[model samples]
Target: MAQLIKLEDYVSRYEWNAYRYPSQFIRMKQDNWKKLYHLWRNEAFVGDQQQANMEPAASKWKSLFKFGFRKTAEETAKNSDVTDLPATENELRHYFLDKLYPVQLKWASSTVTEVSFVDQTYYANDRLKYFLKRFPDTFLVMYHPVFNVKKAPVDGEIILISPIGIEILYLIEKQPGTLITADGERTWLVKEEAKSETKILSPLLALKRTEKILKSILKQADIALPISKVVLSPTNHIASLKAPYNTKLVGKHAYEDWFAEKRNLVSPLKNHQLKTAEHLLKNCRTTAIKRPEWESDDNSVFPNDTV
Candidate 1:
């Protein structure tokens, strides 16, 4: 899963230490998975050999210990049934993907911070889930972030910082089988089956505005990073006379290849990537109150190597 480094202007652990949290999150996830797997294996061991032979099943659960929830495993397992245990490697993996993924996203985005003050809308949003869960862990995302420009807050599209470069993404969600036609700078035409064509304000306007803001900030910081703009519609087709000067248009046909290329990327956290993320977080407009406990004993809650 891609790490949600920032969500809106909510206080993020990444904002506390961009250089450290990514690696720490990866370790935490691994450790949690191991703990859950061991618990599952132990619960699966059958005590009665005759019953085990009669059943002949690989494993049977005595309890279902919810792995990634905020509640402790013992608490979550109270009402769960023995039949819910994952019996195979694939089943266990799917269980994690379905249930524990949200917990992982939460831990990566807002752990060790005052998450209550943050808006809860995006926590259940499908679009945000698509961005956070569909990409690799190495990809750090700033979802619908607000940046400070000349002391004015400016909203931006989704920005993804990877090991090698930055991607400014504008996701267009239209009905499946719809065709999106590029018009001029101000609008684009959308064609739906059995309905009249309509024009909507171009997504590029927002893309350009965000690009300009990022460019200006990076310039001031003297940080040179490869930046690219993408107009992506994962479920629709796009038709363009010619590609825009520096932007890439990705629609349904090419979505798989584009997605595969990103998932295939293999690299450790790069120094430049961390530096760029730190600078960007510095310029973002964040709204959060200090946790009362932290105010009393600030150093006590800082995340450690063990997470």
Candidate 2:
């Protein structure tokens, strides 16, 4: 799953320490997956091995563990808890998707803030799921992030930071089989199945704005990384007379290939990658309240130095 480093202007634990949390999240995810696999296979572990395997994720997220990741009892009741052990492989995947994935996202995005998202509604959002599940962990995404450019806050499209570079993605989702014609800088024509057409504000405008903001930040930081922009639509066919230079246009027909290329990329987390993310995050506009308990109970909220 791609790490959701930032969601809008929501506070993130990643924002606290980009270098630390990404590696920690990867470790936690791997460990949890291994536990799930063993449970699914019904493999017997001897003595302490079984105990260790059964340890709840609360131990991993020491800070948010107290509030139980801030989920209400009713919300928690919606899905089978991970400890119940899934009976089938399909159920196992769903368990991870339904239970663990949200926790990971919360751990990555919100630590000291109250993120108001209705449980079922937020979980069922297809766009959020696409960013989380379709890409690898090495890819860190900032969804609709707000960046502080020229001391003014500017909203941006999805910013994907990979080991290789950064990609600004503008998603243009429409009704299935809708035809999108990109012909103007101000608006694009969307033709639905009934042949009714409408002009919507071009996503390219936002993409270019985001690209410019990132470029300004990167240039000031004296950090160099390949920055690319992509106008993506997974369910609509995009027809463009002239493609924009230094940008990719991925419509429905080519979505799978583009997605596969990202998933297939194999690379270790690089220093520059984290550094770029850190620089960008530093310039983001964050609105969050400090966790009340942290005033006196900082120890519980933070991992031990040894960790």
Error of 1 at 297 (Å): 13
How well is each residue in 1-307 modelled by candidate 2, as lDDT tens digits?
7888887777778888889988987887776666655544543223334565645432332222233334556655643242343446776565555445566556644565443232455555667876687688899888888898778889999999999999999988888989999878889899999788899998889999999999988998899999999999999899999987888889999999999999999987889899999989999988765555543322121233212
lDDT of candidate 1 over 4-72, digit per residue (tens): 887777777788888888897777667656755665565444454455453423333322332223443
Error of 1 at 104 (Å): 4.7
Q: In order, how many clashes per candidate? A: 0, 0
TM-score, per-candidate, Cα-based:
0.81, 0.80
Report the lDDT of model 2 for residue 155.
99
> Against the correct fold, how does model 1 do in TM-score?
0.81
lDDT of each: 0.73, 0.74
Candidate 2: regions farther than 4 A off: 43-91, 112-121, 294-307
State the lDDT at 80 in candidate 2: 29
